[model samples]
Target: MSRSPLEKFRTIFKRSSSNSSRSNSTQSENNSLTMGGENYDYDEPPLTPLELHGYKSTTKHRLLNKELAEELRQHVPALLQISHDWELLYSIEQSGTSLQTLYDKCQPQIGESVNRRRGYLIVVQDTRKNIFGAYINEHLRPLDKKIYYGNGDCFLWKLEKGDVKDLNNKHQSIEKKEVSLNLKVFPFTSVNDFVIYSNNQFISVGSGDGKFGLWIDSNLSIGASDSVDTFGNEPLSDRKKFYILGLEIWKIC
Candidate 1:
């Protein structure tokens, strides 16, 4: 009898089983190459783990300008009134004598005050007194609240022995000198002291002696003065270099 067709077909399938397994293995290896090996392009930059919210590359303090400083000084009188009113809350008793006495003592080198209504005194004058580095009795507020009139000029006035016009004019003369000194004097400080108006233009020259070096903003326009001592030694008739450090003119904007 001829071999049954079913048995023959079964034998053929058994013989080809190993070859079919080999073909499947080869196909899987090819799939691995297609799926596991490909170059990809990055679409975004990676961020570092450590970054501050408001960090700047440069940490230098800005150079203080004369116009800005003058602008800051103009607003102090109203703030002074506000500050003086705050002080009055504590002096409600004793005819407010202690406050008056303290005010009087600081006034000779500072300024005079006249009691206005109650718990208020109008500043009659500002003496432009420098105490170590602060304007004595010159109330300083934060930078944003400082007063200014038109064209970046300041509004300073005198009350005693002056009309409205005189008061306005007196401020002009006093402002130039005071503003000049303030630009130099405002930035130096010790452990117990801190700067009020720091333009960052001047460096603390004699931190131990409360002396700082500053360059006049006009130095660039007028040229460096060849006839004066600009730092420690008082200005002399001969040419002396003013060593005002941290006073880079480029820092002015």
Candidate 2:
């Protein structure tokens, strides 16, 4: 039986059952080659030692500088006020029946007292002549316990002999002195025995017979027992004897 042209073409193109499996296997191999073989993943280049070190150093330096700048900017105003207040306290003569009396005598020129106006500046002169003091921003109340913490706006400062002269000797014509102490103002929250007062506002320094103390009346509250004592672990009551040379209270307007 002779087939027609169309039938003959179909038969020649048809895949026989036996050869179908072989054809599929060959096609899979061809596809694998075209797809760039089995291992075709990309990899990132590794960093060199110099590049790694440089990146670390730059990041560290940037973080440090930022921290320092932020701290200085935040505390500049407080520092200025502290210095001004110190000058006022320094100029006053240390003569009074008691710390409270001294404070009453040296009130700064703060205008009207509308709100609960209360503030104080306390200075202690050790036998060695070193001077240090604190400024409290509120009326201090009597505490039942020997160890009392202070609150409100309170900051402590120290006047080194070297810095004091430089601070005083600056050109008188200048509105403000160019010299500034490295002294940083410590808040009440950062200290332990901030306003150690039983009957009055006072701070005890030293322990034994020579221990010294200062008394004043300013509203201030120190931190709780757990708070960080920026001064140190040695209680203020443990230090040697000292004298209260100056104490002043001002009504903050």
Candidate 3:
């Protein structure tokens, strides 16, 4: 018999925890990991496995509902999809509209994070009513010497409202609007590794030939998206350029 989704979920997490335990001694040899010359101690704790249906967030979020979150979890890289609950790190409406505030508020304060590994999920809604964002492998922060962070596991995505054909009780064909959760994910193509670049002025992801796959301004009010060799993605917004109506970041903890 085929295993259920819950069974598969448990198996994946069980495998991850098992691997983490086997590698603990090897990983613990290095007491400190350096990011921009700043040493951060690794607590080196084992992975904490959650319950079976652990596809929920610790705090509520305006964008990316449970259904969408669960679906997105299914599509992420295997290591990132480990059983974990999300915690709202920052919100443009709640934390204010400044990009600097976003960077400041998104800094990970939880020292118990095993090996200092965490994932950030960003969701943005443009004035055109299109929703899009990225699954970042690292927190949003200013990099020294303008160096970029994150890796190929990071990706971009967009949400759209769509309809499909349906039939009513009378057997008449009709249009039924779906859940408005039509999601398109753009994974890394590995053409160029310009994954994430941030500074006091702006934050950009996936860059090549003077274009960014996603670029947000310092005010967090305006941005642009274009095809980049890094992710080989199309423009994410309805228009090439878009004004942000809402932005939020959720940390997988």
Candidate 4:
């Protein structure tokens, strides 16, 4: 076993201590390296005016991020409208809190609502006068003619020359359209619910031959009876046991 000389070990120990002191000095210098601090390096390149502003880099990045978020927020409504199923997408944001879980919660509604093609629900009360059904434009203004499928027959009427008098005495008549034509829901079965869509889509719901009939309103001047049948008038001959319980339309934002 070879042993180090006592003098040699003492010299090594002194060198180690010297190195430790130098390292501590370097660490202290690094600790105080901020601007205007003792260890700051003035010899380094100076920052540009924009970059010289205190916390300017960080603030600029944050502002950019906020601007991007604002832009996205502004167009979200329009984006939802462009999508095939806007309502389903809109429902996701409704719950708020935790954008991460948005997709999971919305997936089901997207599938169901899109598959059903469901939209907004307009309650056309048969008050004042029984409006078998009503149609509205993008602005939600009622069309002149209202369709009626009462007593197992289909009829059409136009809004009176002006709004009808408030018979309900609730201060306003629900909606008034002068009668145009009366046509039986021939060959189908019965009229349960009739629906109107923004794109001139009109569908009739009722219990009959296992299928529902959909008609299209070509113009406001004509009545429901005069509207062309979008779904074949005599289509689905079999008793499919189909029934139109309610009518709904989706108005995308």
- Tell me the tens digit of each residue's lDDT in model 4 across 1-253: 6665654444433222223343456435433333222122222233221111112222211111111122222222222323332232211113332222322332334334433322221212122232123212212222336553323222222222223223222223232333232211232223334423222333333223432333212222112222323222432212212222212222322
**TM agreement with the true structure for every prediction:** 0.16, 0.38, 0.68, 0.18
Best to worst by TM-score, what's the order?
Answer: 3, 2, 4, 1
**Candidate 2 local distance difference test against the native:** 0.34
lDDT of 3 by residue, 74-113 (tens): 5666566675666767777567788777887787676766
Better of 2 and 3 by lDDT: 3
lDDT score, residue 106, model 1? 26
lDDT, candidate 2, 1-253, per-residue tens: 9998655544544323333244456434333211212211122233221110111221211111111122222333333323221222322232334534443444444764535344444444333334455555544444456655445355554444443332212232112444444444445444344443334554332112222233223332221111124333222211333343333333222
lDDT comparing candidate 4 with the true structure: 0.26
- In order of lDDT, best first, we have 3, 2, 4, 1
Residue-wise lDDT of candidate 1 within 181-252, one digit each (tens)?
Answer: 322222112232222222213211111233322112222111112211122222111122332222111000
- Give lDDT: candidate 2, residue 41: 19
Model 4 Cα shift for residue 101 (angstroms): 35
Candidate 4, superposed: residue stretches over 4 Å from native: 1-129, 134-170, 173-216, 225-253
For the record, the alpha-carbon RMSD of candidate 4 to the native fold, in angstroms, is: 28.4
